[model samples]
Target chain A: MANVIPPRSGTAFTLARGQRLTVIDPCGEQVADLVAFRADDIDEVISSGRTIDYASRIFLTTGDPLYSNRSNVLLEIVEDTVGRHDFLLTPCSADTFRIIYGDKEPHRGCFGNLAHALKPYGIPPDRIPVAFNVFMNVEVDGSSGAIAVRPPLSRAGDRIVFEAKLDLIIGLTACSALQSNNHAFKPIHYEISS
Target chain B: MANVIPPRSGTAFTLARGQRLTVIDPCGEQVADLVAFRADDIDEVISSGRTIDYASRIFLTTGDPLYSNRSNVLLEIVEDTVGRHDFLLTPCSADTFRIIYGDKEPHRGCFGNLAHALKPYGIPPDRIPVAFNVFMNVEVDGSSGAIAVRPPLSRAGDRIVFEAKLDLIIGLTACSALQSNNHAFKPIHYEISS
Candidate 1:
């Protein structure tokens, strides 16, 4: 008889082909923070260039390679149906809450989650940098140069694989509740294993 | 008679209604460390859900009130484009640089700029919280329940205005670049005046 598996929530990790990590939306909807970093001296890591080269395309699916400031490979996409991803935009701050979310000051985005996760690694919030908008699509109008935010073109049960070039500390967040946007906000499943 | 004024690279202003403070391109835009506190007492402030209500949104404009972690209105959005913004994703940090840029960290885009600006004010980078995604459209997707990172529908030269709720310390940077994951990567202009 075949073995039975229970329902899985959140990410399922499976590392291979260099170093692969996948973050599942579990619920088959929504895009969350799945950031990566190159490790240096355990708790030390760095970002790539401040800007993402994808113009407005957000989302990280198959074949995506996250570059670092050092020009070394950080994270590479091995498998992903969640096409473009968002790696831009820093986590929220007080002013952000005030400007965008009037009267709301505290909300946890990718940056907050990363800060918390790295706490065990002796990293604090002050150390969090701008994240790559993985598996998210942010497009710019080539003609007018306008920015357009859209939903993930990927579907449910999709996965993005990345091979880590060097030792790295990847921060994953199953994006919290984003009820003010559009269809892109859905429960997404993730997995990462070695 | 012709009234000749000094030449300015970008627009200069005290920040009025319908005026945008800046445009953030995940590809190259970056805002640094910022400190928000009760304008009354700049000496002491709070952190993590003290001054700001994480559940609510705080609407701001030029010279409007901006509360701190201690729930004291601190700074204000001297300029903005998107009327309502998000306070969740703030500026860059050390960890942020590591995650996005990786081991080969870019010299810029870190919270260093924020800290540098705060140094003169006797504040530290730790005091700054996440920032607002001004001009950037981050709507909650109903079907996916995720905050979609979309480009702002606003046209070039469009504006979002806010008032300083309180006297606050803010550090900003026009992201030099984002090679991580493409979103909105462009030169952002910031202006401040009394």
Candidate 2:
């Protein structure tokens, strides 16, 4: 789609039913680690549950459909490589690492490494929820609705891919280097297979 | 919570009965035109099939508890306007006005100004769906799960207010310079009253 670009040492595909997977990032600076499950019972995804409220932009190109929390249907992109991705926002937390490294260091972030990577599969770090900080840049102020979190149109090795119709356990946050308002601290690399 | 802040010419506070409103935007470019309806039938807004899904930032900020989609308890955020707000991701069709200006002109987006500002009531515009780009900054490539789309961390005025708990008819796109990849053309200004 973007000149058949798909080879950076990390690629894979599959999304049969109702097919459609697209993800493009060209050189927007990679930061993908999506997780899915349920295609044939990988461990139930589509689990935003409670009818799902909102938040999904930390990057996930195309029509953006990988809902769960019990909503089901874990894949639907079709194709893309830089068309634009940033699914809501994530990649920095713990009160944004104590407001950008304050609260006297020793602060564990990225949701404390996603609770030590799901604490060897017992899950519980307050349930690991707030994630998805895709391309960075956040704005919201229509007459005092303030929200100016920017710094990331993407730069450096950018990438985006999708095609997992269902069956996902995707969980990635390879965005270390505690940054604020957007990039200054770098280190983002990702890869996934079918 | 951040010391009362909501006056961009929008008011209607009565979230009393159990106050708990919290709508911040840190820096995501404000866009909060909320509603809940039912403070004794102020036209009803308890269920638009359950709203507030700013994609997935989770709703009712002040401790959280908006629930709907059939979960119930429509309001909570008692008081908020200390930051970001802007959730209305889709509403610019007709090929996005010929792909953001040049398929001619006059596309009017945001579902034609929210169906001409609610067409004096009767509402229509296919019920309008697909919105919730609050704090925009999409990126989905945790190893090929593509979903790029970018731009927007707020730039202009900057606000965030939400205190109704119920009584809604919200609809605002206000800005649609369009170009896909998550709005980056220009034109933003939205407001809502009690």
Candidate 3:
């Protein structure tokens, strides 16, 4: 099945083990926050820390394995059109908006969108996990240990693919924040297959 | 209800929001790896990174809020007897045993025990999250940034209490690893109350 996740919106679906899920940026420069859990036990989830530790690298590319906290493989990158993706940053939230944009208004960021999408599956708004930022460009300054978000390098129609190692409940959210007038976020396309 | 989790064994239970779960070191030298997830969604789970970032500290104590990856409050430390817990280390696993102990023999560490306990709840063995090591004395050397395991400071009947912020499925495992000849592991007691 294929679906389009609108800008600032979210969607959820189940991917059986051995199945594949692909996220596409129809228009370049968009970021998608993705979260996944074991279908049988929601508590066992994808761990960014474990993934980084297991891969021995911070950025993920084709052939990298995403691991859970228990050191179990969750997903494997089977295909990638864009070579850069971030596994070091946490998903943006309302609290992040308050800090970065100085906006006191309720801005449901990727965290809120994910919670809203997974609510019917029994996930509460506050229980959303940190995510894998697909198509996002983040770089670390080695000497100072500072991280900076840069404009994505992916072109329109670029996509990344992952093969599930277990039955997984996956959530995807199109980011809502904008870096500047030159950069604007767009919707993401999803495709899942057995 | 109260239950005694034997040394080298594990247990699982569900706690509704607003309820409390207390972990007690019955014999004073035990370490319990505690992992929690949102009862409904399972995918939104405890994240050591988020908890540390949110609390702004690596060591946990009373009044500290444990946050999930989405920055949601999972549990609050309402009571503590020893006042020290670790949120920086991942649960010990078979692979870790190979690295630390150089033993090729099959060893069931906290990860295996937690997976075994949570199996009945549909959680597989690999989904265990990084745990909060309760009653475990792990000290880090500031100069070298090296962590060393030591005997627990808790006395018999010493415990820590967490008030759940959401419905949670918690798994607790009595550590099977031994520090040395003088340091031995013991059973852990669990108590849940509204």
Candidate 4:
């Protein structure tokens, strides 16, 4: 069955090996934090450093492999309607809000949502790793090494698809960036199919 | 009950808030990869960048607070027999073996051990985060920005203790460095008490 993750919340599910999971930004401008783990073992998870090293690319697109720390291929991107997915950036957390916006009040973010969604399965908040930010616009200036966050370029109905390399448990969070003034945050749609 | 994590293996357990968890280097030369997640949420995990930014020190000692990505205090080092714990380094993974030693063969490492230990709890391999290396001797050269790995200075009963700031699920892995020629690997002892 397909799932519709509400804006600013998260969801978790198991996708069998060879099955494909597609994430859709139904109304565009929303960022989704995508994370995955091997169904058989949670510890040998996707490592951004390793993935960048192996793929020889910082920005992932179709055909790119998401690698685990154990050197295992966990997922392969098969389709991308938005080509600018970021695997290098860590997900926004409460600290991100405090540091960037000087907002000390606890706010909803991808980190918290992922934690809450996985709590039922015994995964705690601290176990959440850095995730792939899909449909989020983050640009780095080469000269200054400065990063700028912008509105996603994807239009409504845009999606990214990945073929699972192993039986996997996936987590998705409608990012907290919804609170930002630059973009409109909207609900995300997902499907896992063989 | 207390646990003895075998060399090159890992185990997971929950430590309630205010509880203390001590990691003992029974044979002195071994290193342990310590990772924690807030027991209630898995996404707001330990971040080396945040911890370093908050502590203002790269090497951890008693009184240093390990900060999560959300800027929350996850653990406070309350006691230490060796003051050189490193929360900055990512755990040695299978890729480490392949890159440094050129060994394409699958080797036992902390990443694998953690994934195996947490499997029953439903954490997948992609969820393991960067870990705090307890008793691992990693020295950084300031002038050249180079790093060197050395045998730990801890003695046969050296240990470090942390008071949980939040209820937590902690994972400890006997590091893969046990296979390195510079040091001998041995079992690590752990205890959780009020």
Model 3 TM-score (2 dp): 0.60
Worst ten in a row by lDDT for model 3 chain B? B138-147
Candidate 3's error at B154, in angstroms? Answer: 24
lDDT, residue A51, model 2? 13
Tens-place lDDT digits, model 3, residues B63-164: 988877556889999999997666545666776566567778947777788888888788766456567888767654432223566777888899999999
lDDT of 2: 0.41
Local accuracy of candidate 2 as per-residue lDDT tens digits, B1-194: 23222321122234544343443433244333343334443333332212332223422234434433223455544444332332324444443455335467556544455556555555444334444333443333333333333454554544444444444444434334343324333333333333
Ranking the candidates on lDDT from highest down gives 3, 4, 1, 2
Compute the TM-score of each model's chain A versus the native chain A and list the values: 0.72, 0.29, 0.95, 0.94
In candidate 1, stretches whose alpha carbon ends up further than 4 angstroms from where it belongs are A1-17, A42-61, A92-99, A103-107, A142-148, A179-188, B1-194
Error of 4 at A117 (Å): 1.1
Report every candidate's CA lDDT: 0.43, 0.41, 0.75, 0.74
Q: Considering only chain B, report the TM-score of model 3.
A: 0.94
Q: Which pairs, if any, clash in model 3? A: A42-B42, A42-B43, A43-B42
Model 2's CAPRI class is incorrect
lDDT of 4 by residue, B65-141 (tens): 88876788999999999887655346677776686557779575787888787677666666667688888776544
True contacts kept of each: 0.00, 0.03, 0.05, 0.09
How many collisions between residues are there in candidate 2?
133
Q: TM-score for candidate 2, please give it.
A: 0.26
lDDT of 4 by residue, A62-139 (tens): 998888766788999999988876664566677766765678795757777887777776666655666878887655
- Using TM-score as the measure, the top candidate is 3
A31-112 in candidate 2: lDDT tens per residue? 4434344445433443221112222333345555555433345665555444444343433444444444555664454445
